[model samples]
Target: MSLQSSNDGPLDFVKYQNVVDGKLVASSNGETYHNINPSTLETNPEVPLSASDDVDKAVIAAQKAAESWAKVPWDERKKRLMDFADALEAHTEAFSQMLVKGNGRPPLHQKIIYDKLI
Candidate 1:
């Protein structure tokens, strides 16, 4: 199935990866799992299969950031959340398509969910 972004025309093919500590990281074991396209039943490139080590790193990173995150002013935190909402709105279509491709959900259903959640 073809996926297109209204503003960007055809969607560019992208390889998925794991994000850890705000950075894209490969699994320590170099293991990956295929992300199968639901519609086409085609497998995309392998994405990182995060092992226990990766989870440990992620937890440690979150723990380290907890103090600063907790110290942020309420208003600033609200503003940051609003900014994030705006960013999600700007990319709604793209994100919806990603849901379809990644989760094999119908675009309409995904859009509905996005509308409610985002």
Candidate 2:
């Protein structure tokens, strides 16, 4: 039910949903697919199998947000981008472990890559 990474600690069970309109939502038909951990060959989470309807809804949401996003000031946009980068840097270890688990890569390899990037 959950993904466990030795380096990152335990991840609680979660149902991965499609992000539509900045909200987590299931597929229109409630279809799901297993997110299997490659190393352990275990299902950690279930992600939505989005259909055409879900794609349409997501496209609409993006179209609606595009105008406002484009109007944002350059400074504010840069700040937001920096903030996102900072957050990712802060969680590099956890993310590296996740990459290892999901892709069946050696933990050391992932850690090295994360170190180089972050």
Candidate 3:
């Protein structure tokens, strides 16, 4: 994220958020907790410390989305899922970095997942 911690100057973090109803959001209280990289022991990324309200919102959004998705044809859904996979494949490098930054995932772990995606 291009956000600065309260006491720190600037954070060199890749923005991460909770996506609800097609919108990105922070915790209900706007609170965040550090995600420390296991290898470096550095908190490069900070993530939302969601509340029960966030879970409720996400559940409601998922229900609404499921209702709409159920109406879509199976073939169209399949095509869209394939397209998503293709998009992920296209951004394997960047996505891998994000995974590593967001969680302390090893390169091999990412490689295995990418290989399965292929």
lDDT of each: 0.77, 0.76, 0.75
For candidate 2, what is the TM-score? 0.77
The local distance difference test score of model 3 is 0.75
- Writing each residue's lDDT as its tens digit, candidate 1 over 23-83 gives 7678989988877887879776677888998889999988977878899999998987887
lDDT of candidate 2 over 1-118, digit per residue (tens): 1122235744433546788887778999988887678888876667789999999999999998888889999999898777667766777777787777677888999888887875
Q: On residues 12-105, what C-alpha lDDT tens digit does candidate 3 reach at each position?
A: 3366688888888998999888767777677766789899999999999999999999999999999878866775576677667666765677
Ranking by TM-score: 1, 3, 2
Candidate 2 residue 13 C-alpha distance from true site, Å: 6.4
Summed over model 1, clashes come to 0
The RMSD (Cα, Å) of candidate 2 is: 5.9
Regions more than 4 Å wrong, model 2: 1-13, 115-118
**Candidate 2 local Cα displacement, residue 29, angstroms:** 1.0
True-vs-predicted CA distance for residue 114, candidate 1, Å: 1.3
Model 3 has a clash total of 3
